[model samples]
Target: MGAAEHRQSPVGVRGAVAARSVAVHIAVLVDEVAFLLRPRDAGWVIDGTVGMGGHAEQLLEGSRDDVRLLGLDVDPAALAQAAERLRPFGDRVTLARANFRDVRTTAARHGIEHAQSVLLDLGVSSWQLEGSGRGFSFQLDESLDMRLDPSLPETAAGLANRLSESDLARILAEYGEERFARRIARAIVRRRPLGTTSELVAVVRSAVPRAAWPRRLHVATRTFQALRMAVNDEPGALRQALPEAAELLAPGGRLGVIAFHSGEDRIVKQTFRSLDPRRFAAVEPSPLTPGDDEVRENPRARSARLRVLERLP
Candidate 1:
């Protein structure tokens, strides 16, 4: 199959555009990721969250055929999709089935010791949002399984049912930045036996006033984000991954992170600030947002924020 064909023919697609987004629609963002890398020299690069191989393939496409890519992903489906997406690069691309938190070890195992650039696009990928049956959206009525990796023990349902109401409220408030976290958590606890995305959505909708719901994007949105974060321990993994990326970079190497939420952006900003100011200079003090045109084309790009930091030689 051609490169374009390979991307669209994934497991399942909800719509024509969504299918295409999984396929070739996102290739353009690859340039943005490569721009952050700015190789400087022909050293290796690591894509810590190489989802669908969108960025990695583009980086390899412009580099010498022998340039290396050490790509990592915790989701098996993502790794599989990336393997196919980057098959054109052959030996130049090395895909790993691992979490971003294990980036340093994964890269080292592939013999990529001094990375020239590292790009991590945190959170769920579009493919996961559309294809993975992990119940990532309130739009879907599937199981309450939000674990990015199904191998994990606790699913979103488990957490929703098991976590103390206070803990659940905190997760929603802190990780999801939801204003009505306490009310949502209390409603969830009261409406026990929550088993699917629809059930969770209903509980949240009922707990939130109609007028208040419209002020925010959607009543169930934050709750979904909160559960996914908890299921994947996304913040904890990111906390470990960013420092690992910093340590793994060669002198003068650059690191870029694409975060989708404030909690993540705060972590990236604070961590970069705490590092050696001279050794690590910010490339974009303010995170880069998608252009209006890009967002118009793909609404998913709306919340994306890209931040870059480069190490001193």
Candidate 2:
């Protein structure tokens, strides 16, 4: 669909031109992110997961002077959309096709020593979940290719077909936090060579008892999540990126992250707490969640958790 056709809600766009060109990807906790990062005085700002440049554009517009922004994302389509939306900013913004895990190398390649602020919005964008034909959502009947970056060697289909029942169980149990992982894994192994999201959903439904189906969540949700996380090595990438981001921040500069799941939030909490107390302090003792108004407007924002920390002098 064209960008104009994708308008669901108007976000933080300042001009009519940008509002028209940019798709409707409602950035979760935009005000909270801006408050924590406060790039108005920062010379350089980094958006580690600049999905559609919603947050990046807001930061640039909110800034006072020439604040250069470095935006990184693994998906080429997302980068293209971001480029189009942010074209008005001219040379003030730089877009890179890379994962957030490579933040250090990307910064060095761009000759950036340190950044005054960094933002990581870890949740998958609405565009990817709803529009991308790469099978990120169980509601879609697309191929089971959940690689956020198409260039990635592994796909969800490969993981489902190749892994042993026990290994698959471990992935579902650990990554997905599903209680009936073993039964689901066994069912998946028996239904080998599943190529599409519909097939996987069917297998999961058959394995899980009718009474055990969650009230709010789909039975196939955990299985799909585990497979996607395994294919992308999401947790490992986050672990690598956190330390690098902490080290790359200028003194008093802040890093803000928005996580959708518990596993991701746990990692963010632990990593931020592990930083030397003398040099780092949590901006908020507890993670921030979306208010009732935001959740009512965008259901996806309901599970988002925002965390911020600052590097002290």
Candidate 3:
């Protein structure tokens, strides 16, 4: 069992003392889950990407006592955090460390083959962005490690530095939709010893037009996104996961997905369309975007788009 599972509850005086020492960890887990899942349904729900349990907390809050949840994530760190945050609900919650692609398997493991509502927040967690020591942000010069699960062997740096220029270009084009993929790939090859995020960022800057710098975020933003997706097989994962989620949902079950980029959002949009309308229907012709006030409070949510679909009888 992890520290989170073993930790005492904050119900007693000892729990109070422990709280002072571990306050930051506790606070983050609570705060994160609160922001991710917006639960309005009064039935079993699944948080397919329960990163740090941010959305899970919100879902639990919006639900009645009978409305249970099955939370899943590939990251063990995220799972540990979730375990703690949802502990109050006890047996009412089931937490698992696994990719969302196995939605059916995950649900079955939790004795939940079907759910009335499913929410997938596909963005990397703030914990992963800030403290994972993996090179996620260009702002950090850390080692280029973007694997969602730390147990994974491949790292972003290995992909960026190892793949052939042509292959690299293709990844950027397909995954990042980057226009300067060829230039970026060629530049990366020339700078073969790329190790840190900043180093890669500098190379990308050299490859793109100087005028494009900062105006559209970092020039290397797309390149980094491409590498992360390829390393993690995220797009492929989504293709598999969405359909699995659709299959596992009960009649009248609703599935909601929050995608952070156009590539991801496109996949969700198309997948929802491909599902038979006789059996399932899109809840909205368009996805929902974060309001201006929400964006002001949480800039990371600016790119989010939420799409909900309902399974037919």
Q: List the global CA lDDT of all models.
A: 0.79, 0.85, 0.76
lDDT score, candidate 3, position 131: 86
Per-residue CA lDDT of model 3 for 1-313, tens digit only, reads: 3212221221332223223322233222232233222334445788888877766776676566877888889899888888988888888788888889888887887677677677787888778888888888878889988899888888988888789999999999999989899999999999987888888989998999887665746778888888989989999989999999998877766677888889999999999999998888875576667545455567777787777777766
RMSD of each: 8.0, 7.7, 9.5
Q: What's the TM-score of each model vs. the native?
A: 0.90, 0.91, 0.85
Task: Give the poorly placed runs of model 2, Cα more than 4 Å off.
Answer: 1-25
Which candidate wins on lDDT? 2
Q: lDDT by residue for model 2 over 1-313, one digit each (tens)?
A: 3212212222331232222332343598876666567564537899999988889988787775668999999999999999998999999999999999999889989999888888999888878987989999999999999999999998999999999999999999988999899999999999999999999999999999999999989888888888988999999999999989988888777788999889999999999999899888887788888766667778889889988877776
What is the TM-score of candidate 2?
0.91
lDDT of 1 by residue, 1-313 (tens): 2211211221221232232323344743444565556464566889988888888877777665545888888788888999998887778788888888998888878877778788988857776886788899788889999988879999999999999999999999998888899999999999988899999999999888887885537778888998999899999999999988988877767788989898999999999998988777776557767655667777777888888777776
Candidate 1 lDDT score at position 184:
94
**Would you list the clashing residue pairs of candidate 1?**
7-23
Over 4 Å off, model 1: 1-29, 38-40
Q: Model 3 off-target regions past 4 Å?
A: 1-43
Candidate 3 has which clashing residue pairs, if any? 32-54, 33-53, 33-54, 33-55, 34-54, 36-55, 37-55
Ranking by lDDT: 2, 1, 3
